[model samples]
Target: MADITTPDLPHSRHWRFSLDIEAIGWLILDRAETSTNTLSQEVLSELEQLMDPIESLAASEQMRGLVMLSDKDNGFAAGADISEFDDIAEPEVLRAALERTHRLFARLEQLSVPTAAGIHGFCLGGGLELALACHYRIAVDDDATRIGFPEVKLGIFPGFGGTGRSIRQAGPVDAMQMMLSGRNLRATQAKRIGIVDKLVRHRDTLRWAGRKAVLEKRRAKAAGLTERAAAMGPVRGYTARKMREETEKKVRPEHYPAPFALIDLFEKYGDDPLAMIGHESDAFIPLMNSDTAANLRRIFFLTEDLKKQRQRGSSFKRVHVVGAGVMGGDIAAWCALRGMAVTLQDLNMERIKPALDRARKLFQKRLKKRHLVDTAMLRLEPDPSGRGVARADVIIEAVLEDLEIKRNVFADVEEQAKPDAILATNTSSIELERIAEGLKDPGRLIGLHFFNPVAQLPLVEVVRSEHNSDEAVARGASFALAIAKSPVVVRSKPGFLVNRVLMPYMLGAVERVEKGESKELLDAAAVAFGMPMGPIELMDMVGLDVGKSVAQELGHDVPEGSQFNELVSAGKLGRKSGEGFYRWEDGKAVKGEVPEHADLQGLGRELVVPLVDATEAAVADGVVESPEKADIGVVLGTGFAPFRGGPLKARADGKV
Candidate 1:
């Protein structure tokens, strides 16, 4: 190895330039005042300034190659700074900014010296676009190394020449799917898909790999012949049509127009890379200004805000869940998956086996590596004897929702649990104070209410009662964060926040169903209104028996001889029982067609008004700390239409 030479360029704030004796110039991105690097306007401006020095070095013929990497430990860059998006109210301003980025990246791409991106951690969105501009992308093959264009998640597609370059490198179908879905690909997956040129197993070797690739003039993998053929006019049109159809099934064109716009762009210009690159801004600027984009960006920030609520000093490692039912089992599995040592207790191993089976499936899906999956699985133990209580940092009782059973379970837990261990209940509707009765130290008891399908939902209402110490509440919220859940601190009230706000909306749907409105029409209306699932389908998924129990606990008016009671009595429990308001097959609702001439007008508003009202009432009643917390709870906990922001936000915006 030869000695390195430092460049005496005008002082750059965000980028550092150095030239090795081998003449491999290194441009390290080290955005100041941030733990993670984002391509903010200031950072980009500094990058553009540094480009003059880069061009000077290349023009002098001293720079043999250029290697770009990040100085941040977490990732290369998290894409363009999303905070900057909020201030750009005009399309022309956004378009001008996009053009600046394009010109900068184009200069990098057209550099005479070979360029390589030494990627580690997350190389996402604009970061990925920057890498795509490079001659080669050498990625570190680690869990943190994810590569993708994720701008679609913000309701916009990439505008900095990514649309054309990604298609050229990975082919049209793969590129379109990547942009349309906004899904990140792991390092190995990126390499396999031709988005990445090389993968090194360790981060220390990333620069070495990039330096070698750049010095050797290593060519990136080109789109395969089949992929190239798919980009032809007729083939591209067929592919785009199929993509549009699939996208429509998941989201409507009116609700999410970015994906549709991308499809249109690709279909029109898939064969012409320069044309696609030139036209990307035309498509991107409009979507960036859409209401859906604004709302989705708000949601992105809301989630970021929720992340800040994680208690600073608190840490929870061992979790003990005392139930092998759906909620308990799934909760335990998720805890284990998030790197906690979890013990799931039940009556016997027979009851525990199913939970383990579900955990195995979840592990396989998430932790793709066999060793990783095995490691996660090993963290979860089946403790039918309830012995884990003594060692757990947090012991959650997810037994039957019955108050007496919960009380009895806690009384025993209090006897065996460690003195400082946080005690919690997974009860959706049961009041924490009532469940805290008979506990020796009631102040230690808090509510960590996880929603159903525990692995999927993000919100965990950390219910704080009058008796709970603030420290205990903070620790409870911390534990939720430890398991990768958003914690909404709520006053311990009936049905807490999410379920309480949700019950009225769900019950209203039931009343309408009983009033001769078609179940399919009711659900379709809500789906059109932006709810993930219809109220009727959601009810079936929640289980008729459990829904009735929560509704009754909340003191809702469930008249005798109602359809809800009739279904429960007839053993048509719901998706669990394979029957309810709708039939269930392979875990999906089987719905019949809506009757002709059935009034569907204002049905969505009619169903959601109660939910919005309940959210406002909860905020007013102090069930949650603020209207923002109420919105976060409802949006995250219930999957309230994210594009509407939340029920409260929708109501505030007068969308309701």
Candidate 2:
């Protein structure tokens, strides 16, 4: 409102306040910090500071209605600024903060006239909670505009009266699912489910949201959004983050206090929306303060950062796989998903079927989701005897790890491939330079390593050898991206980044088992240490044979006192062979007879320490531990727990 601005208040967020004599007052909720306004602590404080404006105006009969809108192109408000949660201390402190926020929202709600939140662009978490606090909400119908409380993912939930408010407005069923799943709702879907009072197209937003606010003459009779959100489904949703807490329950059971504190705030203070909202504001203290959350957040940002990273300047458009076994099938499927034409080849049909089948399933899943067209599967083709090798821009050799076999595949694939084609090996154990030596044009050779079940894992290892050209490295990375994977370039060393670190860790784990450390204790301790799977459990997934092979690749001098290789020789091939450190029955891992302890490092980080502090201290100045090598080996070699960010990072974090 033109008449509403405090003469002394600074306009730091680039917001302008003005009142319209036309009866509908206007306030542009703009923030200059970024392109969008995040409902940060400062924003909540500002919102509280401004509440007196409407109350004072109404008391003096200066304004009849108010329209809260964002001047920015794609947002109303993106909820509570999560950055504030970075250093929260205690649950009580968090609760106090929520109480303060509740007071702010309550003040805004008590206006005698009417209030409306005009939402667009990422109406998520606290942002949507703010809108729910308003008397009425109008959203612009556009793909960019979405509504959801995604706090559950971070082991938190909408603390700003969102669970209660949305439940009241949308009723129990929809409200519970919305918060629990933290699923997004488009404006159209929002209207259908009664989550939004009204949906307006982008052009009609101001007019509709403003008119709807002034038109909403009736005072909210019962508890609105928060009340409804708490009462949904058989789950009997509470004013707390019950919907979201379900995930936390399964994910962090041992760390009950972390998730429970969040739920406790909601259950304890939710009755009065104002009180619960106040409680909500302070929730960040315990939620953010906990070490569990800290670790989870660290992991979250770590992997998320990888996803956002790109291969600098290079772009890969085509990829070719030189084998069609389970690994190659997964590789091809991943390529197709990321908008790449993948030519999967095998020496014969025996190997070809597995790769083709894997790709077929991957594409079928996409078809079900409608993310890829049903016709996209036609792009995948099989080449027995390396027929498509020459036409490919990048060729990945997914053949066995056998030295002679890998060398032979390289020799044949090189002969068939174009002069400029980047030849890569999916070999997990073989040294890249040695295999490249088998090629005439060694400069064209590199390692394009993918994990088994490539469609799922996000990592790919791009091995750059001395002979490899920058062009080859660039394309290898591009192909990794083309397959929708995170490619971390590593040095041309045996076992690459992940395994190099992992060898010692595994040897340590096996040694621990061999040393009479109870399997259950080791697993429990590791789990408590935040590893997704314990060492022995991991060995089962990695296939005893694969694990032994990688260990052997690490050489006889790799680590002393681990009998895993001996076990592999004794017929334990891990999950596939149904025996390793554990037994596999019906696709699930079960503890096997405790093998004799083979303890290597004893306790703590002594077992698997970081080789060198600086890259210069290690093998070379620029060696990267391959996430691809780590992920694939973990997935294929030992089932290292995909969501846990693999053993390389885990070992580094655990060891260092």
Highest TM-score scorer: 1
Clash tally, candidates in order: 0, 48
lDDT values, one for every candidate = 0.89, 0.64
For model 1, what is the error of residue 235's alpha carbon versus the real structure, in angstroms, after optimal superposition? 1.5
Alpha-carbon runs more than 4 Å astray in model 2:
1-123, 134-156, 166-249, 253-257, 269-275, 300-314, 348-350, 359-367, 370-394, 407-423, 438-448, 467-484, 515-517, 556-572, 592-622, 625-656
Local accuracy of candidate 2 as per-residue lDDT tens digits, 1-656:
22434344344454566666455666677776687778776676666666666577767767676667777777776666655676444667677677787667666666777777777777888778777767777888776788887766565667767766765666655665676565787788787667677667773556555765676652334435554544434334443454345646454444434345545654565344445544455555555665555544554455445544355665556678877776877777677766777778876787777766666677776555444544556677766766677788778777677888888888887777777677778888677888877577787878877765566556677888878776677777766665666666777877776566556666666777787777665665455434556666766777777777787887834343446656666787777777777778987788645334444223323432332122112234345543433333333333343333444555445533
Lowest-sum lDDT 10-residue window in model 1: 594-603
Ten-residue stretch with the least lDDT total in model 2: 610-619
Instruction: Quote each prediction's TM-score.
Output: 0.98, 0.71
Error of 1 at 49 (Å): 0.5
Model 2 TM-score? 0.71
- In candidate 1, which residue pairs get closer than 3 Å at backbone N, Cα or C atoms, i.e. clash? none
Per-candidate Cα RMSD to the true structure, in Å, reads 1.5, 6.7
